[model samples]
Every structure is written in C-alpha cells, then in structure tokens.
Target: MTTSSYLTVKALTKYIKRKFDADPHLREVYVKGELSNVKIHSSGHIYFTLKDDAARITAAMFRTQASKLKFKPEEGMQVYIRGEVNVYESSGIYQLYVQTMEPDGVGGLFVAFNQLKERLQKEGFFNPNFKQPIPKFPNTVGVLTATTGAAIRDICTTINRRYPLAEIVIYPTVVQGENAAPNIVKNIQLANNQQLCDVLIVGRGGGSIEDLWAFNEEIVAQAIFESRIPIISAVGHETDTTIADFVADLRAPTPTAAAELAVPNQHELIQRIISNKSRLQQMTSALVQFERSRLKKLQNAYPLATPERLYRPFIEKIVQLDMQLGRASQMYLMKKYNALQKLDSTIKSHSPKNEIQYNYKQINHMTDLLTRSVLSLLQKKKDQYGANVRTLEALNPLSIMTRGYSVTYKEQQVVKSVTQLSKDEEIDIHFHDGKVQAKIIEIHEGGEK
Candidate 1:
C-alpha cells in the first residue's frame, strides 16, 4: 500500500479559510446579544463577547468597523451587530466579526429624535422667524430649572458676579425624570404669562441621555417655541444636545454661559456712558467757542462797530454832488447873461430911428424923378393910341354903311353878288346902323348890264 503525504497545518488552515470565504451565509450574519468582556485595543479594534442568558460567542470588531459606532460598547450593553462568522484558521477557532453595531434600546430613540428634528425643521418651527432677540440689558432674568440643582446655583452666581443689579426670578421645576418635561413646560409658560422678567433661561445641569431626555421632549420644545420672551437653553454640556436647544431662541453651552449671555456688565456699561457724556461735553464746548467767535467777528465789522463810519462815504459823495450842481447853475446863468448883453449892443447899434431918416431922403429924391418919367411915357402912349385908332377906322366895315352902302344876305349869309340871291327865298339886309329881314320878290339871272 502507498502512504499519502499529510497536509501541513498551514495548508489545512488555508483550506479552512477558503471554505469560510466560499460560504456566503457563513461570511455574513447578524447577531443580537448582550456584550461582555469588552476591550478596546490601541489600534482601535474591539474584542468582546456576544451572549444570551445561557450561551456565549466571541466577537471582534476591527478598527475600521469599530470607529463607526455611535456609542461606546461596554460590558453588559445589549447591541445588534452585523458581520461574518469565520474561522481564525490559526487557532482553529470560529468567531464572529462585527462590522456594525447599535445600542439595542437607545438606537430606536435616537432615530425617533432625528426624525422629529427633521420634521420640525421642515415645518419651520426652528426657523429664525420664531427666534426672539436677546435683550441687550436685561434688568430681570427668569430661570426655569430645578430649584435644588447645581445649574440654578451656577446661573445665580454668574449673574450676581457679572451684573449685580440684575434681579433673578427662579421658576422652580423638576429638571429630570418622568415628570420633568411637564414641569418644565408649565414653568416656562408661567414665566411668560407673568411677564416677570426681561429674558428667560431654561435649562439644567449635564447628565446621561436618559437623565437629559426631559429636555428632548416635544412638550418642552413647544413651550420654548411659543415663548414670547427670548429663551436661552443651557440644558447640558457642549457634547449633549436637546430639543429645547434647537427650539430656544438662543443656546448657551452651560448654565454659567447662559447667565453671562443674559445680562451686561455694569462696570463696562458705566464706562461707555461716561465716554459718551465726555464726548457730548466736548462737542458743546466747541459749539460755544464757534458761536462766541462769530459774535466777536460781528462786533469787529465796521458797520456794527461804528454806524457813522458806514455813512461817511455817502455824506461825502452828497456834498461833492451839491458843489458840482452849484457850479453848473452859475455857469448857465453867466452864459445867458452874456447872450442878452450882446443882443442889447446889436439893437443899440442898428436903431430903427436912424434907418427911417435915411429912408425919407431916398424916397423924396426918387419921387421927383419918377414924376417926370411918368409924364413923358404918358405922352408917347397917347400918340401911339391915336394912330392905332385911325388905322382901325379905315378897315372898319361900318364905313361902307356911312357912305350909303348896305349888305344883303340869303339864309343869314351875306350875298356879295346878284347870283348869290335866290328867287323867293328869305333874306336879311345889314346897314351900318341895323339889320332887316326880307324876301326876294323876283329872280334876276344877271346883274343889270
């Protein structure tokens, strides 16, 4: 018989690893159990045990998977883990590898809180619209918390130290446990209804999730949201968050911080007021100096200093004008007088008495010569007139009538020859003295020959 060679341990382990990797159901599984013997390694791996009341199985979470846990896994903590059940192959032992884990009971509560937060945010309950501004100088501060807790004492001490004048009104209520949410909401409403303070601080000291759960209640959140007064939420430490923190107008990291935010320091406020008063005094002094200088300048002005000095130039100008007017009137009178004197001299030199005497002598001599010339011209004219008259008388037609001559007319026209007269025609006869109408009694062909 031929003897087969035995597989080495390394080869057997490799074969087991291969079988584990090939089995999909063995590679991945989820286990729910209470955790035990929990140990965190320097490399961030977690070694623990997952067991029921009767049985137990070893579990390991590598650094990469362990780092993702929201809450630290402690001994006796119940959790749900998702990972693989695989053989280590070196030790020939099978163990569960945890890839993900969540706190068995708290995880559901966390999920519910997140869902509500998202819903409230979407509905604008946490919007800036609902956020009241903190009073700059709160005279009275209202605190809503357990009357016996350290949170209230811390707040009162901080407020007293920073602003002594501030009056603290404590609205005592339970800050934790089952009845805490209703008490908190009622006290917040009472504070607002009383209008007893300028600002409100609603919070308590830090604690675990279960202890801090009252602040995360919806009733507490709604009370904070409906507050007319500004509210500062200081429920827990910086790492702890509550619904009140989201719904409050402002959030402070601790109870002492909330008190600091509530009131102003009296010393700093007094310093600022003093600084402002000093500035006002300085401005007043400068204004008074400016006005005084202006008044002095007005007093130094010539018109205000001496009224007569302002009118001196006008008086001098009027006097000069009067002197010029006097000189002009005198010059005009002298010119008129000179013109009249020349007229008087010209009249005396050419008098009408002298002119009349010279005219009389010239007239007497001219009259004698004119008389002789007139007599000679008259004699010449008379002789010419007689000769013209005789020439006219010789050519007159009436001379023929004076010598027994007459004229005969036919049809009112003179008949110079016998042939011109017509037989039995009306005729007219004209002598030197008168004319007579007639008719031809016979016809004569020729002049009597």
Candidate 2:
C-alpha cells in the first residue's frame, strides 16, 4: 500500500476534531445527564463525566463560564448542559466543552439556596444563641437599603412616628442585581465600624426572588452574622425569607415592622410612664405612712417612755455580781489557810533533827545485816576448805602408798612392769614417806622367770 493510503494517529485525530468542530449540529448541543467524577480545580476549571443510562461522555467547563453558574456541580446531580463537542488532540478523545449548566428538574438558584443554607447551618451560622438582642430603646437607628425606595421611607416614617428621640442614619446600598451582595456586605461592615447606631435596619422593598437574591448571598449572611450592632432583617414581604433573615439578629415582616422593633413607641412609653408615676407615688405614700407608724410605736415603747426602766436590770445584775465576788473571795481565803496548815504539818514531819535520827537508825540496821551476812559467808568458806582438804588427801599418791601399795622407778621414771628393769639394774622404790634404792637382780615376765 502506498503511504498516502494509510493515516497516522495524529492525522486521524485532526480529521475527527475537524469533523466535530465544523458540523453545525455538534457546534452547539443541549444534553441532559447525570454527573460523575466531578472535579473542581484550583484554577477554576471543572472536569467531569456526563452519563445517561446508555452512554457517557467526558466533559470540561472552563473557569470563565463556570464562574457564572448559580449552583455548584456535584457528582450524581442530574443536570442540563448547553455546550459544543470537541476532540482533545493530545489523547484523540472527544469531550463536551460545557458553556452553561443548570440543574435538571429544579432551578439552579433554588439548588444554590438550599446548598448554602445547609452548609451555613452546619457551621453554626444560624444558631439562635449567637443572635444579639435588639434594643428596646435605641438612641440612633441605622438604615441599610436602597437610597430611593419605599422601604427607606416606611422605615424613617415609622421610627419617627413611634420613637421621636432616636436619630436615623441612612446608609445608601444597592439591594438588587449582580453588584448588590457585595454592596450590602460593605454597608453592613461600614455601619459596624462607625459604631454610630444602637440598632441597624437592613431591608428592601418586596420583589421577585431574583430581585431579592442579594440577601441570600453567603457574604451578606456572614456580614449580618458578624455585625456587633443588632440587625433587624426586613428583606421582603412577610412570606419571602432569605439567608440574611436566618443570620440576622432579628427578622421583621416589613420595613415598618423592623423600625418598630428597633425602638419603643413614644406614645406607649408616655402612657406607661404616667401609670408607673401614679404607682410610684402610691408606693412612696405607703412607705412614708409605714415609717411614721413605726416611729410612733417606738416613741410609745416602755423602755423609751421611762428611761430608768432600761438601766434597772443592769444595776441589779451589777449588785448580784458583786455579792458573788465577795463570797468567792472569802472561799478563796479559807482554802488558802487550810493549805497553809497542811504545809506546816508536812514541814514539821520533814525536819532536819528527825532526818538525822532516821539516818542513825538506818546505819545500825545496815551494820547488823552486814555482820550476819559476813558470818554466814565465813562459815560457808571454812566448810568448803575442809571438804577440799579431804578430797586432796584421798587423791594423794603417798596416801595410796600408805595403803600398802608402792611405786617403783627406774632412772627417775616410774617402772610400770618388770620389763622396765634388766638384770642387775639399779632401781628406786617410793613408799608412803620415803624412797628406797636397790639393784634389780633379775627380769621377770608374768611374775615368773
């Protein structure tokens, strides 16, 4: 085959992309499908897969168009897309270049409203505990709304008619369209920074939901939530609610109602003052009468009427205490005298002359005991010495010799047997009193020769 008969992958991809781009039917198409694998890049592009029951196609939404979207695209959300088909030359894959996307069965705005509401609710933005209480009587009231509108007129007229003392500070704001949300947020923060108002009334005249969308923005809701001054939200006619209504410190049905809530009615206050003044006068009169009666009772008291009656009990108590003190002194003196007499007897018993006599008696008794003990000990020692002398005499060899037994010695050694002596050996014999020397004539064994 010739080279011209075959096509490279790049050539094939270019041909397919050209076919996709030139076709009028594929140039701008509308599709309804469920989203899958949705990815919102940090660069503001969204990449996702769009699928119905039978088929799916890859899709990409660039940042410029995506920024215009009212609601965020999420996985599994059924959506309608108006876009053009194109081929990705790098991978030879076809994808839909999304231009505009909206939720399939509902308005995108409604979806966005619910999504933001649920998110802010979870973040505790709508908690009642964070809500500030509106002032019953404000010195200054701030109005945040369109400069030329019935809302401003109604608020100013209502506040002036009800509470004339309160000063009104009007902050002109954009209450509709694309620039409205940021403008409203700016005025809210500005009023807070000025700190000029005791309470702020933020509202606009009733309109369609699109005309009232500025109040539903998250930034506006955050601004209302963070404001130090209490905010009364009058967004629309009674039935229309916005995110600002939920986040504000208080919500009013209309601008006039918000003004009434901000400050108390002057006529009501005057009537209340008159009623309280009458009640206070009655209370003061009753209190004065009660104090006068108490004074009269105190003046008529028995102790005050007769001054001497108050001190009589004290004088009697002093006399009784004196009598008790006298008795105590006499008892104390008597006890001291008895103790002195007992001490004198003890002193006499322990006299030095008596102590000396007792010592002499003790010396005599000790001498007698020592003499008896020494005599008994001397007799015991004498008996023991005599017994020892008899035992020594019994063990003496001389005594044994005297009993007819004698010891024979040869060469100064005692001869125990006849083998100790040889024939004609000289020998010595020890008797009871003396020793004898003799010569051994013969030797003997077993007493025989």
Report the C-alpha lDDT of model 1 over 54-164, residue by residue, as the tens digit. Answer: 999998999998765545677887888899988887688779999888878778457546766877788787999779999998889999888887899999999999899
What total of clashing residue pairs does each candidate reach?
A: 0, 0
Q: When superposed on Cα atoms, how far off is each prediction in RMSD?
A: 29.3, 17.0
Q: lDDT tens digits, residues 122-172, model 2?
A: 999999999999888889999999989799999999989999999999999
Which stretches in model 1 have alpha-carbon errors above 4 Å?
A: 1-106, 306-449
> Candidate 2: which stretches are off by over 4 Å?
301-304, 316-449
Best TM-score among the predictions, by candidate number: 2
lDDT of each: 0.88, 0.94
| Local error of candidate 1 at residue 111 (angstroms) | 2.1
- Model 2: which residue pairs collide? none
- Model 2, position 432, has a per-residue lDDT of 83
Listed in order, each prediction's TM-score against the native is 0.46, 0.70
Q: State the lDDT at 95 in candidate 1.
A: 90
